[model samples]
Structures are given as structure tokens and as C-alpha cells.
Target: MPAEKISSLDDPRVYKFTLQKDKELARDQEIIVDSPKVVLRMMDAGRTPKAILANQKFLDDHGQRFEGMDCQVYWADVPLLEKIVGHRLHHGVIALAERPESLKLSALGHRLLVLNGVNKAENVGTIVRTCDALGVDSLLVDERTLSPFIRRAIRVSMGSIFRIKVRTSADLFSDLQTLRTSGYQVLGTGIAPDTHRFDKIDFAKKCALIIGSEGFGMDSALVGLCDAVIKIPMRDHVDSLNASVAAGILLQRLGAI
Candidate 1:
């Protein structure tokens, strides 16, 4: 039987038609093309369809195909994306995607990092990258933390955001109690004169590192709840480091490097 042709974008039958390898190759190679929506995954070095759409002439010619559907054109190359997103790297495509739902804290365990009130998307992204690099078991984001999958976060993380398990919390203190009950040691970061160095903390035991925001630092209530509060020693007038930078330092101190 001859395969049916798709006549309309809205037809449910249209999804059933699979593009053959040759056809897919042809589509990928075509200089000007259109789709209902173009999903970009990374903005690395490459000739992307997104790049074409940024051009007025090319968009004028091919933009009609993407008409009526949500459209985003990446006129700026990788450097421009980096500047706009506040991160240094983008893997050539930025995917237009649905936001993923958050997981529950009850569903997590093992080595975990809790982000408290860290609002900078780039910081969130960098921590995610460190977590993945260190093989940390999971990530928990309090209400104040930025979404790990946001464009700047994704770009900064170099896609490591997808590799880590993430959960959200309305009350991080309550969540800390749950982790404590589950035999997880909750450690908070601080730089008071009496605090222990992060390297002295035993990470071989089940643990969670509570990282605070870039500006205000962790809440005192949360700090008091920790099994221990630790800090990384520094030189000069550096009173502190960026939350993400501190996270990487702590991870390395814990032998995660």
C-alpha cells in the first residue's frame, strides 16, 4: 500500500509519517527550511537553521513555513548567545522546550547538594556542572533557587543540567529534617572564624551540602540545622566566593575533583 501524504500541520495523521534517513538528510542539508517549531539543543560552532532565520532576507523567504507556530530565531552566533545568556558557552542550538516538573525530596537519597535561595541562573548552572563532574547523587532546589533548565543555566551547565536529579522545596528546613531522618548528614557553608575547613568534613558518609545565595548567604535557621557548618579558607580581602565557585571548591575538597 502507498504511504499516505500529510496535507495539514494540525492533522493527527501527520505525526504518523516518519521521515526516512535520506529525507532527513535532505532536510538537514537544505539552506532554507521551515518547521512548526525548531527545537535547539545547543549553540555550539555550526551552521544552524536558527542562524539562517536571523538573516532578514532568509527569514523573509523561509519564515512563512514557521508562521503561526511559536518561532525563535538565533541571529547571534555562539559568542552572542553567550553574551545574552551571561554564560561563556552555548552548544550551537537553544531548544524550545516545555519546562520539566520538579521532583519530591522524599524520592531522593545518596550524595546530594541543596541550593538555597541562589537566584542567579548562571550560578545554578555552574553548580549543576560541578555536581555532575563530581558524581554527586542529586540536587535539591529551594523556592529561591533559579530553574536549572533555564536558557542561561542550560548554557552555563553545558547540558549537565539534564544529567542530575533535581527536586524543589517550599520549606528547606523541613526538608533538612527529612534528610536527617534518612541518615543523611546535612552540611552548610559559612566562613565564620570558628568554622571547620570543608576538607575536614567526611564525605564518605551520606551527605548533603547546603549552598547559599550569592549575595545574602544561607539562612541562619538552615545553618543551625546542619550537622556541621564548614568553609573554604582564602587569601587577600576575599571575604567570600561566588556560591557556585564555593560549591566547586567544596566538592573538590570532598574528593569530588
Candidate 2:
């Protein structure tokens, strides 16, 4: 499809493309992917966008990918595009898509990373990329977790979120219990009297690892529910690591990378 030109910011089709508070966008069910590279990655992941608003350069380079795609395409000058999105168009492209229906919890892949209370978008993004790199099959975000589709997260994730199976779990505790009943071990990251050294944990089989929030650790109830609690053995002076850094280290061990 030829790219439609977006001249007016007031154009109804471009409303969703315009910039808004992250809170508002997070509440919406749509995923807005920016950057030509990330947009292509999303398409390669088999995500058909509802619409695309981009510049001519993006079209010139990759329009063929949309040959038979059933979606609206639009383009505008860089300045006008920036005005619409309330930001500089470093990548000169953006795509709006509806969140795809998630798979059932029982249907998720063998290895999973469950976000318990981790709420930072950047951490979630980095974890998304880490999961993509380390072979974690899916990401399960609990109710306390923030939306992974936030623009910052999508940018930080480098489009890995589009490729990964992610689900915002309504009931993570019960879900984990269900997974455990199905022969999958549920692992939580934290340091407790009974917690095992992360490197010593056997991750050879099906497992779901839970990452807690940055400030507080995992919820006590969730911690009690874990098949085992594991922790990164660090120097005595250091109390804890950044959420993303800890997740990366754990994931490296999780996938044996």
C-alpha cells in the first residue's frame, strides 16, 4: 500500500500517534513502536500494525515489506512528524498496533520470567532484551508491574517485546501455582535463610523465575509460594543490584549463556 500523507495533526487517524503522558498511553491497549529498525523488527515478528505513520525515507527503504499488509500507511515531513509526536524523529518512523491476544498461562513457553513488582519501564525493557538474548520463552508481568508496551520500554527493549510472548497476568500467584502443578518449578529471586545460590540452582528443566521490584523485595506471599528462592552472591558491601542488572546476571545463568 502506498503511504498516505499526514498533513494535519488534527487528522483523526494520527491522534493515536501523537504524544501523550506515559500514564495515559500505558492505559491504552495499543502499542506504539518508533524507529524504523524497531518497526521492521516488529513486522518480522509477524505483528501486523493497525496503521503506520512515517517519513519517505522509511518508505523508500522498507515499503516492500508492507506489500500485502492490510493496514493504513501515512507519511509526513520530519518537522510536521515531530510536531505530531511532540519529539524529534531520530528514526523518522512509528507504527501503531493493537495489543495481540495473549496465550493462556498454561500455554506459555517452558522457560518464563515473571515480573512480580518490578515497575521500571527501562528495567522491563532491558529484561525484555535480556530474555530475547538468553532464551527465556516468555515474560509474565504481575498486576503490580508496569506495562511493557510503554514507548520507553519498546525503545529500551529494541523491539524484542514484539518477538517475545508477554502477558500481563491478572493473578500471578495462582498462575505460578498452576505452573508448579504442571511440573514447572517456580523460582523467585531474593536472599533468605533458605535461598540457594543462583549459580547452584538447576535450570536445566522447565522453570519460571520471578524478579521483584527495585526498592522492596518480592511480596512475602509470593516468596512463600516459590519452589525455591535464589540469590546472586555478591560482595558484602553491596546490598543489592539494579533490577535490570540482577535480571541480566540471573538470566545468563538461567539460559546457561
Tens digits of per-residue lDDT for model 1, 1-257: 11122233343432211221223423343212222122222212121332221323334454454454443443344344334333443223222333345678766657789898999878988888888788785898887787675545765776666567788788889989988988888888888887788767676467888898878888888877788899888885998998888998887654352
lDDT, candidate 2, 66-165, per-residue tens: 8888989999999899999898889988888876666688768888888988888899899999999998868888878877888888989999998788
Off by over 4 Å in 1: 1-92, 254-257
Clashes per candidate (backbone, < 3 Å): 10, 0
Residue 120's lDDT in candidate 2: 88
Tell me how far the alpha carbon of residue 78 in candidate 1 is from the true structure, in angstroms, after superposition: 13
TM-score of each: 0.65, 0.94
Q: Which residues of candidate 2, in runs, are more than 4 Å off?
A: 22-28
